[model samples]
Target: MDRHDELAARFEARRGRLRAIAHRMLGSARDADDAVQEAWLRLSRAGGAGIGNLTAWLTTVVSRVCLDMLRARTAHPEEPYGDDLPERAAGAGPEEEAVLADSVGLALLVVLETPSPAERVAVVLHDLFGVPFDRVAAITDRSLPAAKKLASRARHKVRGTPAVPAAEQDRHREVVEAFLAAARGGDLDALLGLLAEDVVRRADPATLPPGVAAELRGARAVAEGTVLLRERARFAAPALVDGRVGLVVAPRGQLRYVLRVTVEGDRVTAYEVVAGPARLRGLKLAVLDVPAADWAPDAPEGSPSSW
Candidate 1:
């Protein structure tokens, strides 16, 4: 085979391994693919003859690509893509690592998200992937001991104790349930008690009534507005939105909007009512449990299932 084709073959041979690494570094399978492709582009441009270890060279390239992506992500929080959502995946991609990581449940993933990019790299590489701290330090541009410290701190955040992941998910679930109950009952005090004083609620323009503001700030405003939606909550059901506890509002089993939330400690810091068709379709949504009343009997010809 010609030189280009030979290098391509070598890359394909390591595709799965590279994908697994990228997935751990970047939580999204789609983003992992992007990082992998970027690695290939650079490899094609640079060639492989000069590299002594293709696998290690590619790993470092992909890791650096992922690090840049993470840094950019922090600079520009993913804009709610009501307008710019990427095309849908043609089929399942390299989601197994992402799924298995999630299978430990979202508490771990949420905790992982709190770590800085360098800390995430150190923790995921050294702790999860069994990489040596020296290499991890090379990837993160830290001293070996500094890289070890990053992983140590992240480990504490993720698992104050080994049992924390499971316990934290349960606590988060309860908080969601309580918030829903309060919203449903139009209990102002209960709603206030659940929201952080700095809680912010943002709604997609498509979800708002004409002229209603898209963003609402402060716990009091959020609570008051939530209580006003008591009637709407009648059609809401608990679900997991983007691997986190959230709610979907389906009137007669047809999804009208989704409430995606960000919780810190016991209170909600931010939430968005995503109703635009494009944005809703892009979310990784799943019904948490089959609520009997999710699709009211005798009420619909188009219910979304037992969710």
Candidate 2:
């Protein structure tokens, strides 16, 4: 095969890994696809010229493309989040399923989004992909030490808000399930019992189109806020968010809320309800029916899950 054909084959071999990296960096499958396409274009134009590691070179190209896109996106924000998982047959291979599961996990992606582009690139390279700091620095266009520092900072930020113990996370799910049941049943007392005194709930202000209440604070305020959605909002499914139990609620088919229940000891300390399609889109959740069986809590930890 010609050098160009050889290069194309090499690029194809790394497609799955490249897509995963880009998806984690860009937080959108569509954007990741675009970035990868752009990377391929760059590679094709370069021909057989001077690239040492094809995978590393392609990764850098995709990273740069994604960074530019992210910067532009900040100037013109789009819908915040949505499902980006590619549909697959039920008989897909275990490796494909694992990749799909990790790629679409809302909590990990959300945490990655908190960092700057450089920090994200550094962390994903060094931590996730096992790239050394010197290599990461070259890819991210930073000095070796600077790249290490960026990765360190990203690690600190993420580890500081580590996922709650699996057991606590499971208990949180139970609390949320109970609350949802009570809400659907219109049992105000049971619903209130599940909430903390200083609970805070916020809807995506962008969705309201001006002059609408965006934030609701305090237990009483939060309880009253639910009243507005009493008949409209419906719970579709539940997931373990950042090692915490959480539920997805849709109002009028727009995916209005992601309710993350916070627990401290035996009592619920906070119920953070993130609503509105704009914000809910950040969580790429698979819409599934919530099972009735009680999911056993994973092992307990001292800290709660970061919502």
Candidate 3:
């Protein structure tokens, strides 16, 4: 094969890993897909010559693209989930480490969303990918110590007790499953039993329309919101959200409304529901149809099982 063909082969091999990283970093699968495509375009033009680490190079490219997108995203606003909103992956194969670093769970991704572009690059590279400060410095165009500090700051902001243990996560899963069953069956009390006394359900402010930014607090409000959603929106399959049980809701005749549920102890404590055409693109979900059974609690990890 010619050098171009050879280079194309190499780039294709790394697409999955690169896309996974971009998805984690961008928080939108569609954006990640775009970033990966852009990275390949760059690689094709440059040719695959004299590259010390092809994986790292592609990761850097993808990160840069995502960073640019994030910069532009700041200008536009998002929407809130409908009043009827439901409360709702790993490994790079070698050369895959750079992209696989921090792309694990929803909690980590949400935490990552709070940092500036530079801080995200720093923390994700050093803390998650094990990349040295010097290399992170290069990628972020900052001094080594400055890069270290940025990562430190980001880490501090997101620091918390260790995540709920895996076994505990399983238990949470059971509770969430029961809650879903009850909600789908229109059992109000059964659904409320799965929520904490102080449960809070807030729509994604970025996606909600004006005059629709609503926050449902307390178990009663949450339970009420659940009923509203069940009566209105349809759901795609259930996907494991942040390593816990969760599902995605796509409203009838609407292209958005992705809900992710966070279960604490035996009750639901947090609900993150996002709605917007752009954000929904990355979710790879149907426009108005409820997701398939594949999105249920037992679906494979990282599947578009839930929002």
Q: Best-fitting candidate, measured by TM-score? A: 2
Lowest-sum lDDT 10-residue window in model 3: 298-307
lDDT of 1 by residue, 1-307 (tens): 9999999998887777677667666755667888899999999999886987676677778888888987887786542333232333466333332233222222223345457878877776665445678877898999989989999987665543221265565667678778877886688999898899999999887555566678889999999878765655544555667767777664311356778877778988888988876777677665353233421222211122211
Candidate 3 stretches with Cα past 4 Å from truth are 75-105, 160-307
Error of 3 at 92 (Å): 22
Backbone steric clashes in candidate 2, count: 7
Please name the candidate that would achieve the greatest lDDT relative to the true structure. Answer: 1
Clashes of each: 0, 7, 18
- Ranking of all candidate structures by their TM-score, best first: 2, 3, 1
Preferred candidate (lDDT higher): 1 or 3: 1
After superposition on all C-alphas, the RMSD of every candidate to the true structure, in Å, is 14.1, 11.0, 11.5
> What ranking of all candidate models by lDDT puts the best one first?
1, 3, 2
For 216-257, candidate 3 gives per-residue lDDT tens digits of 789887787777655332233244444345555432112245
TM-score of every candidate? 0.51, 0.56, 0.55
- So what's the TM-score on candidate 2? 0.56
lDDT scores in order: 0.66, 0.58, 0.59
